[model samples]
Target: GQQVMQIPQYQHVQEGEDFTTYCNSSTTLSNIQWYKQRPGGHPVFLIQLVKSGEVKKQKRLTFQFGEAKKNSSLHITATQTTDVGTYFCMFSGGYNKLIFGAGTRLAVHP
Candidate 1:
């Protein structure tokens, strides 16, 4: 079975520090999607890329689409309590059954 593994499952960081999350898949993917969820809120769309070797960034965050589309990574330059949230990456090709990567939950210390 195809599956993605995320490291640290969760992280706790102090303000003004750096944080990172990694996503890896057992099989190649067609496209990957990232999302963020607040403490008590639903996930909000952050970014999505389908092309191979695609990369995107927003402020202190960087996203990468693996050349094989089987893996991806996310990096944050600095950590802030406001950055507290869960990040998820999904890989799917079918119309009805969208496979998703394991999510990484980040926690920032104040």
Candidate 2:
């Protein structure tokens, strides 16, 4: 069995502060996907990281994958209330099985 471990189960940040979440997998991943779930809403796909040592940015958000392809991180700079949500890292196993991290819940205060 494979597992993905996510750190900082919960995060509280001031409006304009930075926040980050880390994910590590027991096995090397072919690709990893990030998701965001707003309060009372279902998870929505944010981005996917496929290459080793890859980095991608979307506005104030940045994503990185380890060279070993066993770890990943998401960082949000200048956090805003709009960024308040739960972030999840996921990977697909064979046979269409998808495994998700425990998720990091973020709270932003203005």
Best by TM-score: 2
Query: For residues 67-109, could you state the per-residue lDDT of candidate 2 as single tens digits?
Result: 9999999999999999999999999876699999999999999
What TM-score does candidate 1 get on C-alpha atoms? 0.90
Number of backbone collisions per candidate, in order?
A: 0, 0
| Candidate 2, residue 33: lDDT | 97
Off by over 4 Å in 2: none
RMSD of 1: 1.3
Tens-digit lDDT track of model 1 for 1-110? 66777776888888888888878887787888888888999988899888999999999989998898877888888877878999887767567667665677898878
The superposed Cα distance between candidate 2 and the true structure at residue 39, in angstroms, equals: 0.2
Name the runs in model 1 displaced over 4 angstroms: none
Tell me which residue pairs clash in candidate 2.
none
| Each prediction's whole-model lDDT (CA) | 0.82, 0.97
